[model samples]
Target: MKQTATLKFIRKHSALAPICLIILLFIRPTYLYAEELKLPDIGDSAATALTLTEEKMMGAAVIRNIRHAGKLVDDPLLIEYINNLGNKLVSVSNNKDYRFNFFIIDDMSINAFALPGGYIGIHYGLITASRNESELASVLAHEIAHVTQRHHARAYDLGKSYQVPVLAALIAAIVLGSNGNELGQAALASIAAGSAQMRLDFTRANEKEADRLGIKILNKAGFDAHSMASFFEQMYKESRLYGSQGPEFLRTHPVSQNRMAEAKLRANQMQLKQPPSSEAYYLIKQRIEILNQPDDKALLNHYVLQLKNKTYTVREATLYGYAIALLRNKQLNQARKVIQQLRKQAPSRIAYLITEAQIAAQSQQYAKALYLYKSALDDYPGNTPLTLNYIEALLKQQKYGRAKSILVTHLRQPSPAPKLYKLLALIESKLGNQVATYEALAHYYYHIGQTHQALNQVNLALKTPSLDFYTESRLSARKKELQDELTALAKKPS
Candidate 1:
């Protein structure tokens, strides 16, 4: 058969035209293939108009893309704990009915932001900068107030020039990388909701409203309302110290002294409430500090001074931080002494058990570490950190089978951790189980938003001739599910 004239026209423009021509020839009547590819209906362009449901769906898509980009904290414990604390503030807010998702961004930029549909991202550095739980809660409440007030939706294309696709792509840029279209950047910075002049103008009222409501939330949520003002005042002063190179949150949120004064006056009128001491917040802060600079000598020295001066609120957590600093610095004996003190402070605390186990691991006492892990897991069944630590000990001891068994058991839980899938892949590879290895990798890829790779892996698993009937059925179902997910995503308008 002779080649068609249209195929020749397409071929002149590209090398891939051959493939394109072949696809065109095979799709029955050729006219259908001529239509340009566009996602499912994005509806009318009503400039900056987005419904709550549409915003939620959009946020869901952006979140997966962000997660896949590796900007999110990988620690399941930190993720869950932060969400829990954020939820505490949400529960008392005017928007108590809203379903919020909280996450920690691994960045140390000292910022926190609320995205569409109750998705909030807090930086690890912001958590570290917090002097108390109230300060942190105040920030979250402010962000929450933004969400509740529909500021993101309000900031939507006021001129109706931008569409959902632009919004989605802009967020992907911020989450995945810094470089992006100037227009998209402006749109997102506005959702930080304070970026450009127009954004600043658009969001000024929203910011004031957020401050007012945020303080109300602080009081209602049992935090000192004054914390909102105090935290802002601190950041404002720090910005002065840096001569404009202060924390990024200050830039995004733009804390004016007048705004801080208003917050202070509002807080003064409300009866002060003594929020219950948050041991968990202090512990997590200590963990964040350790994470940010695991072995920085200057940071260690700062902690040493704090420990010596008895300046920390949660003395036990401060001690924990000091111990971690020692352990990282190779002061093994000092770390051991700190561990003993932790044990004395809280005889049966899970934190103490985990800390001691870590010390044992560092000391090369694998047997002792394994024993402590087992004992703790026995007490705190289904504890992710403890179980992961136990698996680490097993792996260190070269007990692959035991580690595999524990991993498999964890996999049976509802909503298993993605880290479990990644670890299982590693273990399967070590055991030379190619089929199971691919299957585990597939799950890991799927969780991380690599849909096509997951599809490929499941297909490979199905190709293994030794697979049992049940295993084959599972892989086949998984492949189909991934295929459907890709189709749905592709069909959805950006």
Candidate 2:
């Protein structure tokens, strides 16, 4: 049968029409799939239903991504000890489905930050500045609240549109190999260009929520809720005295009179069951002081004066802090004298023996640093940090082969810090492995001259997916320096 004019027209256009339709589908996916892809309502209640497992995976991903792009401090004992404290806090958290991790950054800035899951960073400066364990716990507890409350996810959901520019900046750099400064400048510019008032309001709201939740969590964990108030009180006083130029704590985290009053009121409301300080708290405190404390000499002198005035607690804390200073300064005999007194006063304290061993090492007494580390291990076996310290002492004595063996064996074990990877890099560098040497050398070079580098290397490092603040800073600085250099070079007489 002969076809009608309409049918003939349809037959001729069918092939081309389907192809055109397919092209439209590819180009305008949003219109086609908008209903299916719409985001869930990011109401306050919606955040509560986010699974702990999802949070953990996201948190761990953030940790791993940032770790790859930055340098983590390589102290085993410190990392393990802080993780233990974090675990204790997690045990008492209202939401205990997820695991908490604590990492100590080499950064001296007095700040603590949390990732979406359970990744918490306790800055070396925060540890040093804290007067006691409860002060540190206050910071940890606050971070734990951030995780439990799903603040990261909630923030992401609320500000998904705002992240577009930051995300674009990152993607452009990765795709185009843009100069480090260009990428960092792009990212920082986006942060600066955003609505500052809105950001501040959000931050303040989160901070208040975190403060109340942290106090409740601490009280439940048998910590003194008053300690949180006390910690902020000290920080507030420090802010008044220093007035904006003080430690980094005041810079990133602002404290005000209202905050202090509110914190105190919250603390007063809580029925805290205070518990005695555990051995872990004291040990971590000792480690913090040893690794930190800029004015060691003055600290010792002050301690002596305090002792003469019969200020027992300050005297005790200072003596413990001073003993480590003495070891570090190579005053072995003096350290021994201080530790001997400490041993007499607090017999069976493992910290004194550890200090004793360190002093012995400083005085060419390897046998003792070795013996004391071993003795501490015997008392506290499975102490990965102390064991690593023992291995380090051996390495100090030029026992590379033995240290290498121990490091290799432990490489198979769980390591929060990449100890084995570091050891392998160091050992291979020592053995004249050119490839290994350059890899380690590149890392060192980038770390030491962070803000300045060959344009090529700076551009390369900026391509990393999840840039940490340090890497971000380095890339920014290097980019500026290189741009300036190029401008000057272009203006030369040649």
Candidate 3:
């Protein structure tokens, strides 16, 4: 009789009770009202039918925190490579424009996450954890699945708006200088925090569904579908070996027994005829490790292995990757020599050109860097990353006028990034145009930072035209926060 009752409870609750028991014992619940609540109407309809303006707005707030909390790894070649793979998968994905932005975060955490409207955050740790491009694709496709499936929106409507609170909490922690991986773990803890087993697995089911969908997407995109299962199997083994000391990614994204089984079963069913070539795998793996490791004998040790294998183009690219890593580590002289060789090998690569310019600028050869940047633009028109680097070089040289000119030109062209406004503010300030500078800064601050001055700036800047969805969202959120702050200040003054 007791067993029957226990089974009934477990059935009704799904598989969330275990997670809840673990989390509730540690932290107080933020959304107790959402614990095991039901809302069939939530997130069931197509995205086309739902009003997403508010969700997109909430996403903007979190994006600023995400961008601020994590450093964007700016290897154009690697980014292009990753994006090419991502775009291939996205082509077959339902959320096509969710125009997914993929960038490496400068962290060692083995994790990946996505924000609404196509923002994907990948860690160097996760990059290294992935054995190949297909495995990396599995991670991205999973996150993209969340956005496509509207999991956050569903979570919001079902649970009464947890996304905003979670984003706010994360941003707050970041502002307080908390470690991003640590804060991210905390955020994930709060996700299924106080829920019952049934409720928690409801979300896990979504995760499982995403995994299945992502595998299918990979299969169609000509990537090895089994890579998903292979990566999961590796992660599972690592988890067991390390026990609780495993990567915190496993903690938030708890690799349940069923998930592992499903991954294996799915991989076997797919029976891919060929894996991604060893060269591609090595490219991703070496790039990941080179980026992850600090400037130590460890990097040199790996370099020795590459040196011994002259026939390996993958190793050669890794050598170039190591050189770039060395430059980032402030080994300027070593970086210059390696880059010079890289340029000799691939003279037409814009990234090598930019790196050379960066090296010259670092050595206070501003004119050299400036000339290289100009030549690069002339050669490769409409290269966004190079354009950003060129402007950065100009700013470093205190060529505020040229920087502003670049910003104005770029802003006028088609489909500019909202972050450009923030850059403009910096350049304007450098130009000693305080009035225009404050106005621009206000736009960036209020929209990106959700500050009062930012609200004021947005109002000033957009007096007579349509604001992009990103800026509009920022303006609204900042205005609200500012109003609340003013109300509290007014009360204190009395």
Candidate 4:
């Protein structure tokens, strides 16, 4: 049956020849069943097998590859919202010391996955498919449990010779493979070749543990405890309807009737709390829906129909999405009118304010856009979306110095997005700061997993004429750091 499944997968994804070739070269046919491996108790034994720092590095490398592949949804608003939601759950989690980074994948598949480290990715489809924030939070909680429980490390502890880099590559391939891209398909096909199972399988014991712990976390975090069971029931229903063609999530995180019943029972025994979903959840869902539509006119028309027919769950969010669609279509007047209505309803709403400012910018009314951005920033200090939009408007108005100052200040915060560095690189280039430009560009490339390009950029910066002692020393140190990282990556066993 496993061989049959593998053959079916290969038949379905024949385009993955290139990636399969690479995988075939390295991976040997091996079957490691979860039940066959004894899971270490949650303690130092697992940590000894794979250090936290090493896990983090592996996760970082995978994330960089994902970014380089353009698989991430880079919208600041969506990213900020997901991170805020994720962090809320993390705050109440048992592993408070672990730093969690949450991101969204652009794929329209109902799936979410946890990397070896505290990196969690949710597909946009999963967000939209969720009935409410509680459901989304439930999924996050489960993934977090997987991470905090050190499941990956425990697995490595059991499978002593399993290469860490190979595992990381397998994870990357699994994630990208679901997107049905050539490389992803190849990776998936290769994985199937190596292990007849096409999906990442955690132990049955692990899934039950995650479900139990995830419910506790959800209840503590003020989400509905029953959401896990509710989501499971939904997936179970989906599987019934579509059989093998069910959601990508089902393929990875398998759901069974017994599991669903257990989750429901566990949740019911808890002090259940069904908190109302946040306004941001609704707004982000609509925003993603609009942004995902490739046809601008179709999006605009769809929104128009929704608004006209009053078919929206949230009127304000629908209007907000409509405004975004109009903006995309360059319908400045229509977009502004919709945004004005939204602002009137909730004047302080950041989404509406940002959209209004964007419309002004699109109309070439730089002063108006700048004023709107400044006013919004004053009200909501240090807001990332507002700050980024403000910087963009400043750049457009040739206010390079102010833009650079504000951007530099923003970069001081932890884990600034890669786009910020790219913007800084552009700003430096425009100012004719060749050294700074190369340095900024190097940072951008480094963050996005293009280590070779980043290294070359650093070399270019070092070769630039007349570097000050501090500048030269900084560049040299950065060059060495990047080189060391590259060397380590190269040393990983195939």
Number of the top TM-score candidate: 4
TM-score of 2: 0.61
What is the TM-score of each predicted model, taking all chains together?
0.71, 0.61, 0.68, 0.85
lDDT of 2 by residue, 1-494 (tens): 01132234235444322322222221111112212325343345344333565455444533433343453455655777788777777778776555677887666656666654567777777886777777788888877876776554433321432332233232222212223244334443443344311110133455577788888878877788888778877877887888655665654455667777888899999886666666556666656655655776865665566567776444555677777767666677988999889888876666666677777877888887887887777787656666677777977777777666665665566433444455555765566554443333343433332223345455665665677788678667866765553342232121
Indicate the worst ten consecutive residues by lDDT in candidate 4.
24-33
Per-residue CA lDDT of model 3 for 240-342, tens digit only, reads 9998677646654556566667876776777574555544445556666665676666776566666676644565567666676666667889889988897
Tell me the tens digit of each residue's lDDT in model 4 across 127-205. Answer: 9999999999999998888788876554344133233344454456545653434324333433334432112233566
lDDT of each: 0.69, 0.58, 0.60, 0.76
- Scored by lDDT, model 4 comes in at 0.76
Clashing pairs in 4: none
Q: Whose lDDT is higher: candidate 1's or candidate 3's?
A: 1
Ranked candidates (lDDT, high to low): 4, 1, 3, 2
Deviation of model 3 at 402, angstroms: 3.2
Against the correct fold, how does model 3 do in TM-score?
0.68
For candidate 3, what is the lDDT?
0.60
* Candidate number with greatest lDDT: 4
Candidate 4 deviant stretches above 4 angstroms? 1-33, 36-47, 157-170, 178-205, 489-494
RMSD of each: 12.6, 16.9, 8.9, 5.7
After superposing candidate 1 on the true structure, give the runs of residues whose Cα lies further than 4 Å from its correct spot: 1-57, 94-99, 148-169, 175-177, 181-209, 240-243, 294-315, 329-331, 398-417, 428-435, 449-452, 466-494
Count clashing residue pairs in model 2: 1
